[model samples]
Target: MKNKVLLLTWSALITVVLLASLSFARQGTGLIGNVFSDFNDFSWQLDEFYDIVGPTKLNSIDVEEAKKNITVSDDEIERHRYRYGTLADQLSNIHDQYAQRIADAKDAGNELLMNTLIEERDMKLADIRKNFESDAHVEAKIRKEKEKALVQYLNDVKANSFSLPVAYEFTDVETGETYSSGDVSVPAVYKKQFNAAKGYFKANSLPGHNGTNGWIRTSDYGNQAASEDIQITTSVKTFEGTVIVPKSAVAKGGVLYSQYKDFNKGRLATYVFWLLGIIALITLLTVMKFQKEWVTGTAIADWYADLKIDLKAAAFFMTALILVGYIDSKSSNLSNFFTYQSLGRWGEWLTSFLIGGVVMTTLFAFQLVNGVERWKREGVLAKDIKNSFTLQFFKALREMFLKRSIGVQSFILLIGFFLAGIGFIGGFIDGIFLMIYAFCVLFLGLPALYIFVRRSAYLNRIIVATEQMASGRLNEDIKIEGRSPLADHAKNLNNLREGVRISMTEQAKSERLKTELITNVSHDLRTPLTSIITYTDLLKDENITSEERAKYVDILDKKSQRLKTLIEDLFEVSKMASGNLELNKQRVDLTQLLQQALAEHANQISESGLDFRTTIPEEMLIAHVDGQRWWRVLDNLIVNAVKYSLPGTRVYVTLRKVGDSAEFVVKNITKFELSENVDELFERFKRADTSRHTDGSGLGLAIAQSIVDMHQGNMKIELDGDLFKVTVTVPTK
Candidate 1:
């Protein structure tokens, strides 16, 4: 499960990376500007051609005329300097007036006035500078200063320019007859000048009128202009057929020179080859990984099942990936093979498949070996290889596919594939680093989460079971089974449950046996003691006995009878508790039982000088219970009430049907401080009163409790101030 989860996580990570990389790779860098700038050699060549070829002719004419005209003297030089200084001062004074007017307008918050003044100032200043610089000798000096600027502008133009050989068709404005540029020929001088300018204009296809009538002149046509009405047609040509020219020859339609079609084609081929090589390497690695079988000392059948599942999953995943790639390639304009995007997608899918398969296979193998060994001693496997393979295959398939063994296996495969794909895509060192990082996070974090959840649930179940056991409800079954650690813990919990049940059962049995032994011994002793007490009483009552003899005999008879009754009660209590004595249940009247018990204790109650009262409904209160046992219950309560009641205090017995049960309650006011713990009085051999006035056994209430339990009724004792109460509730028919 851990490996499976890891595989899934790894697969997801690889998928994300694959998508991200493809997205990044598709966006070409904006480095064309930098490349153009860096190749300054191209710019310089163009600059030199324009300056030496075009501007040289104009400069020569000016220089030759200057040489024929005159020589400069000191006076002329001084005069020229004075004129230049005067023009500069006048220009500065005009700028001050403009600046003052603009500042004042801005301070007054008059934006309109400020803008107007600034525009007026700029126009006046330009007029003044132009007038000053346009002088013949001044222009000569300016031209010298503008040389570098001219070269730089020309370089910018050349470097920024590109042109395609479009199939041009020109239509005559007058005749509408189309003529191809290839078919037309004009003079070399006209062609050279026209073509240079036309080439430059066409290369830098600006979206504006280049001349009058909205028609641009070509470098091959010199100053000739075509009317806008004379439409020119053009079409795109493949790079293979497009002509390339030298930087110098490019200005005009001179012979085409430099060509890069073959070079670009070769470069593309190299790229494709390299891409295929990488893909092949990845494919080979994946195949090897898939072929490598994992050996786990688990049951062969289980391993086979797991292996079958992993393989099918892998195959399905790969098929899906391939299908998607094929569909995308067919539907889109993207290349069908060797694209960065396609490769990444394939890598991610392959990674997932390989990782899932490997992990599942490994786990399956382990489980299979284990299972096989477990069954080996039982002769589960045949020694024949053919039979083994057949068994293993079917078993493998069932476990792997039917049982969804793919869960853990898929996770493992995903993780492995993600790491491997990451490594493959990233290249050796970087890929390895990424793979390691991914593996650690997936293998560690996911498994930890699973274990945490599993253990938490397991602990919760255990706690609940423990609480039930603590509450004396030990008959609960805890059964947990799985490959998870929590499952093992659940087994332990189950064992603990059984242990607790066994201990409780044994303890209950021992208590029952002890109760039985005591009951039997006490009964045997009580019978003999009862006879002795009866004989002693009979003798004491005889008229022939002397006064001392009668008194001693009466004392002896009282003590003997007390002992006998105590013994009998103890025996009866034990018999009832241990389930050794069967009850003859019948429909007994609860009201009658209470009345009889109260009447039997009436003499004692009256002797004690306590008011005895009975409240029983006249209606028939029927309940299923042993009449003899119920009588005992009522007798014990009445006796207890009589003994505990204070002299002149009232003792009350109430019997009635309350809801679904018949309720019997005996309440009496006690002379002594009522015992703080009433439950203790229900124990065998226990007594509420230390005085021996009551010739009663403490086992009386205990026996009553046993009888009530046998009838599935509830008995309780309560004390309020000097009032002591015993209540019994039995189900009524």
Candidate 2:
């Protein structure tokens, strides 16, 4: 905060200094312009260069009388006398010269010569003492002085005295032909008038009647030179320092230019400098505020957009500048004010600092209020510049271009044809303008329309593909062209189509399996139910033997038990598949659970005459799981192995901890040929043997897989020809 304040102070000071400099510049007061004056003073050889306008009025003077009018202090008079000979010494030299001439003339001359010398000496003495001279001599000296003034004035006019340019124009009174001064020429026909004016001038040198009309300008472009003189006058309001209003008796034709109006350039310059300083200070303040917005962590373009400073304010400034220029043109008084007036020197120095300080302080104060408002508004982005251009063109292109709208885009192209027609028709009337119009239509209009049309066509391809996809037509993928956004969209669309096709195929396969499951389930139920019904009907015969009745009863019990087991297995599998089974999860010893399951199946193992191979780990393999559901997985695997294993064949069972999981493996020789599609065993009502020879529902493996899934474990059935293997893994953590 302290640094920022300090920086603000410094900036204000700097701006003030710059503003003062600018004000001085506007006043035409500058250091470099005085370099020549300084050099002239320092140089040993004095410059005698002087500028004068032609036909200047020279002052008439009597030398002795002028000397008496002069006043000076004795000290200054002594200083001037030491540097140059005084009037006293000049008078003394003149007196001595006359006295010597009188003596010499009397000694060497005859009476006629001495008489002439005596009269000439007395006359010279009277002329010097009383300032008396012949009328012819006085007139001659005045004329000579006037000639010198006239020459100096003319030289001043040639070099544009006081750095003022005087533009000249001449109009022939008889022909009404106005000519640029650079384009006019003196013609032969004017020689008569020139001589007549000269004669008139010699007749009377007092100068009132000594004037003649003359051509003012010369030309070299053609032979259209002036053959006669013309009466001309300057129409502009100003001359260098004086204005010569023709009707005001200030200037006469070919006579003398007299001062009409005079204005001090230094006084006029003051108004100009003030106006410039005021304006510059305001502009500086505005610009400073615009820049300060960026210092408070906001991006520059964003702040510009937020404030509208650049877009609106800059345009206003340009318009104001142009307006001021036009206004200045209509008012010469205001123009003179800018051209001449200024504060001398000290005020210029002070104004610089004042301009800076005032501008900076004003801007700083504005930011204090406006900066808080910036927080409430979201800033603009770099992308907004592009968007701004797009919006600017939206009116022209809105009806057709953009948005992949092919119809609208093509319509614009159609309109372009008519625009082109108008352009061509316009061309014959005016080549330059119409040709420009034609190019605008052909290049700008046609190209813009075509660009949108091309984009629309690109977009249509995607639309067509999307429609086909909605209609369940996912055959061919859409093709892409170019490295534009549409190409990327096309690629994604193609991928979507492929994914939908695969999903449909998978759905169809699942439907077929569901249908097969219903048919197999019915068959399995009918087989067990038939046995129970038939056995119960046979047991109803009164004449049947006890042994026969007992055998039928045993068959009934066996089929009924098999049907119950199948129904239970189907229900469990369905529950797991539907995700409705609630689990009582707890830390259970997987090894102990495996041992208990083996003990429950020991009778079946012993009766089957199968050699049981067990590889149970001694350490507890603990995992958070439903103990009953996990045991069921083990039971199904053991039962599946026992039912499918060949009689008297070796049955192998292994259980161990594998990394973070508890794994169980069961292997046996298949009683029937096992198919290569072993994964089908996990499907409901599916088995290795198609015939219902085995006293087991095919739901065992499916139920085991479901229970394993419920426990978030992995179960797989592996088959190597007649060898069957099932592996189950459950996470221990």
Candidate 3:
């Protein structure tokens, strides 16, 4: 229930965020408006100023005469500063100085001084004019002076201090003669009249000269030559108009309009309201579904957590979308309405939300289903849920799948259908159809394939079981369930299991019988041998009287000794079979040890009437073994060979180093049946002949095999009819 509530909350939050982003995208344009307003204000001010100043007019004679007579040097021009210094004052000083020079010249009658003074004054004037014409500061200064002069002229014109001239002399460039001709000459008269009109200008400065309409003064003389015509070419002052409009009004093409032509303003409010309604509807539906699922006990905590995470992701995406859309709407290059349209944009948001939600939910559901299936298949009991790790995991998984199943499936299907429709309409009908076909194949065919695969796997398991039964091993229990042919085969496997059990029981019984028979025989032989040894000891007393008694005593001693040897051999064989014998291992130099052993048996070898051939290396061949037991093994093999070997034939005792082990071999020509398998000669009481004619107790090889085993070595016998050979291999450390 808690999980369901959380999921609903997450869904609601994501929807709100996406809707808010779309709303913001539609309405935001403050930056665009501010930029346009600033530009329009600047342009409007410039236009108004241009209208007030009008155009400048220059007299042809004045311009032509000024161009021809004005000559200024580079140094003089550079030194001129019309903007910073007082022009009126400087001009007055020049005029006064020139006047004084003229007075002095006239008084003394010095023409040279006066001429020089006049030339200097002309140069100064030419310099000032050039500076004012080219320098921006000087141009600005001239404009300021013209504004002042224009105001004075306007005042003079208003006061009637200036008379309008009809005609004046216009100079001819070639002859320098005056002519009263056409309107060209009339412009010259207007120039003179404008100069004369300065009489009224000297009285007062006009208002509005620094502000808008101030250029009216310059415009009043329609045909008059402007003062400082080259300098005061244009007005610098600008006039501004107050704009009155609603705050909502947007500007377009330098004009503000009450309504936006691009966006459907009338429908915008309705659309926003409708979007809100839709969001609310979705929220309500989601909440109700959550409540329903919760009541039905299907809500999962993990699903709820995933839903919350997905909601946060959606929120982030919506925020980025809103920011980008807002920026796009404010940009000048792209259309605002096209950039901010909510229908297509919201559709995309919805699609993304559905896709993300479905994916998360589906993943969670799959994990849950898999876990639950594993637990159920393993036969985990419900009662052990608290104790079993598997049970708890399955429970958690089940809850996750059940709670989110419907919501996840619905979301996926909706998104899938929406994408399909979009693709179909986007000239991809074939792709849409293909997607549908693939989905069908995956959804329906996959389950069928799963069922078939499962059936095959079950059959394969049964076949494997049957094959195991066919082999010797049938101990495994076949616990397969069902009434199929494979199940019946499994039953047959169980029957095989019972049969194997019975056979193993019978084999165990036979092994026990064999062990009992050997134990009883050995014990019985020991008892009789004990009696004979006791009798032989009694008979060895000095009280025995004659040769017959001596003979009887000899027989008794021989029988006793033979019986003792037989009993000891039986005991040794039994101990070996039971694995009770032990070897005391030490590092023994095989060459030295073999020499010592051969020396101990040297007298016996000589007395046996057989030629004993001993070949061994002088170099030390070390082996890790029981020295005493290994010596005894060699002793038994050589003695047995000498006993059975044909008299007067050679007996060979050869020892050699083979890899990491030493091989000791004793071969002799013997008169024994060699038909028996040589390897089986190591078994207890295994003899070549049924009759006990040989002196050996038939346990020599068995004892040797046991001793070798204890030393972690190997012993074997090889027979070639009357030529028999025994070999013992002891490992070196």
TM-scores of the candidates in the order shown: 0.31, 0.37, 0.33
Writing each residue's lDDT as its tens digit, candidate 2 over 1-733 gives 5535544654554443344454455433432343222222212111111112221211112233322333323443233233224445545666677777677777876667767776876775564443232444433433333333333333433443322112224333334343232211222111111122332111111122232321212121121321111122111111111111123122333211121121223334444544555665675566433444434544543454464333434544554454344323322233233333357644653453344343334344444434444445665333344455445567556644554544454676678778778778878878886868866977797679677778789899899989999999888889899876678889999989889988998899889988988998999999989989888888889999999988988888889898998888878877888989999999999889989998999999899888999999888889999989888888888887777789989988999888989888998998887669766777889976678777778888888888788778998877787888888888989
**Which candidate has the top score in lDDT?**
2
Candidate 1 segments whose C-alpha is farther than 4 A from its true place:
1-545, 691-693
Count of clashes, each model: 34, 20, 0
Native-referenced Cα lDDT, model 1:
0.54
Q: Give candidate 2's error at residue 618 in angstroms.
A: 0.8
Candidate 3: RMSD to truth: 38.0
Summarize candidate 3's per-residue lDDT along 1-733 as a digit string, tens digits. Answer: 4755555455444444444444445534432333332333334543442222222111111223322332333443344463335667666767777887778887898888878888998887666655656766444443454455544553453443211112222332333444342243211201322122332111112222332222233234441333233222222321121112222334343123322333334235434544664676677567534332322234343443233333434544565555445334322222333324578866864565444433333333333443344346554433334444555667775764563643454455556657656655654556767776567547854565575566578868877777786786676777777765556767877887788778888899869756854764565466557767776776778787787577767777776777778779877777877888776788888888778877887887788899989899878888888888888787778777766777899989899988988899998887566665665566565555445555566677778888888888888788877888888888786
| Candidate lDDT values, in order | 0.54, 0.58, 0.55
lDDT of 2 at 425: 83
Q: What would the per-residue lDDT of candidate 1 be over residues 153-272, giving only the tens digit for each residue?
A: 334333442232212233323344433333223212112222323442121111222222212222222212211111212111111111222233323343222222222332354345
- Output the worst ten-in-a-row residue range by lDDT, candidate 3: 52-61
Q: How close to the true structure is residue 316 of candidate 2, measured as C-alpha lDDT?
A: 45
The predictions' CA RMSDs to the true structure, in order, are: 29.7, 31.5, 38.0
